[model samples]
Target: MARVELYVSADVEADGPIPGPYSMLSFGLAVCGTFDGTRFTAPDPSERTFYAELKPISGDFDPQALEVSGLDRERLLREGRDPAEAMRAAAAWVKTVADGALPVLVAYPLAYDWMWLYWYWVRFTSRSPFGHSRHLDIKTFYAARAGAMAARSTKRQMPAALLSARPHTHNALDDAVEQAELFQNLFRWGG
Candidate 1:
């Protein structure tokens, strides 16, 4: 078993068409054990997933994504914390609760979380945790490993044998799971 300290997974609900140039709505995190020769199958049980929502600085949000999230604006305003506060709380929890890499699984281009976190941290404290510039793009790695399996589009492809049902995009945790599935597929195909 490869001794991995920890593994963390994060999902961000963005306020814009995507995750930049606007604001964030909510963020959730799931923490697990590192590789352990099982490719991070079993997460540490003590610290489960934590979900947090934030109030937008301006209420002008992307209506389409909003519909997808199904978040109630009024409820967010009532319950949401400021972005800085939320990020700080998130950082605190991650630092204390997680024990893996500096950053967690984003299932996206690093820029997505980088920008959101940069905006919040700099706006409040003038710093971003991602300054070091180390990140792993799962699809990129998978495509490289699965050169012949390339589907010609800039999206991740799961071999039919690996999928449980159908592919549903945009749901954060679901996407993360799908990405993991793709990685596993690549590993299996390689062997």
Candidate 2:
């Protein structure tokens, strides 16, 4: 049997730099593409996705970070889904979309997003759908694949052909879709 890798483009909006001390206000995931050891299939960004806004686990949050997401912190506190429930739902969604393939989380500059997601998964669900280390950083992937300096691998430094048409609206789902487009572009770049 061949291995199947389901590339999931994920994004997160957080209230602070780290989890536990803050919270993941929201998160989104889009199944960008899949490779079944021989061939690749790139899906439209609007297809097969998940999004959630979670209640805070802590009282601390950075005002500026919260502002960036443009989400009402007070409203989230009042109405957001419980973290455990949200994480469980998210995990189930991932499993359903993945359809037995290994789902690998992909994100531009993945560290921050990965931190919030992995922490939430462990803290709430006891394990992650992507496990502890199955993540791909688009920035690092581009740096190595395009021969650019890792420190200078921002989207501005990328080729226009590889950029997504979608705007970066700071909404977790929008960004996830945008990054999904970017990931598809990169995945089909040389083949």
Candidate 3:
């Protein structure tokens, strides 16, 4: 029997460009759908999801980055969830969503979100739910499918049908769900 693949869309909000120097303020994951050898199945993207806000690991943060995230560092320092605990819960949630299927992380561009998630997972728990390389980039997927230049394949350039109706709110969870919709559309597209 062919192994089933679960696509989990992810988004991250961070205080700085890199992980260790700043911090990942929050992140979210939404199970977009699944694919077996012969077919793709899209369930409600909001049905199985995970989100967390974490305390900063360092005292340092870029003002601009923090402003973009809109996460109060002082508040997080006082009330955010412990990073280790949050990461563990996220891992378990991913496994539960997978339910024996192989879980594959999905993101718009994949690089930034994957970097933060993989780093945090390994740092906090010493393991990652999606493993090191089981992932997909929706942007690249769309580029390849549409036969468009990767750099030129931003959402604005895509056909309206392929875009999600939800606005990019920059709240990790909301963006993740929106991204899940984009993934489902991209995955099922024939062109």
Candidate 2 per-residue C-alpha lDDT over 52-94 given as tens digits, one digit per residue, 9 for 90 to 100: 9988888999999988999888999999999999999999999
Candidates 1 and 3 compared by lDDT, better number: 3
Candidate 3 wrongly placed segments (more than 4 Å) = none
Evaluate all candidate structures by whole-model CA lDDT and list the values in order: 0.56, 0.92, 0.93
| lDDT value for model 2 | 0.92
> Taking the tens digit of each residue's C-alpha lDDT, what string does model 1 give over 128-169?
443434344544555666574444414435456644242645
Among all candidates shown, the one with the greatest lDDT: 3
What's the true lDDT of residue 102 in model 1?
52
The best-first sequence of candidates by TM-score reads 3, 2, 1
Candidate 3 whole-model C-alpha lDDT, 0 to 1: 0.93
Off by over 4 Å in 2: none
Model 3: what TM-score? 0.98
lDDT-best of 1 and 2: 2
Residue 129 of model 3 has an lDDT of 94
With candidate 1 superimposed using the best TM-score fit, by how many Å does residue 10's alpha carbon deviate from the native?
2.2
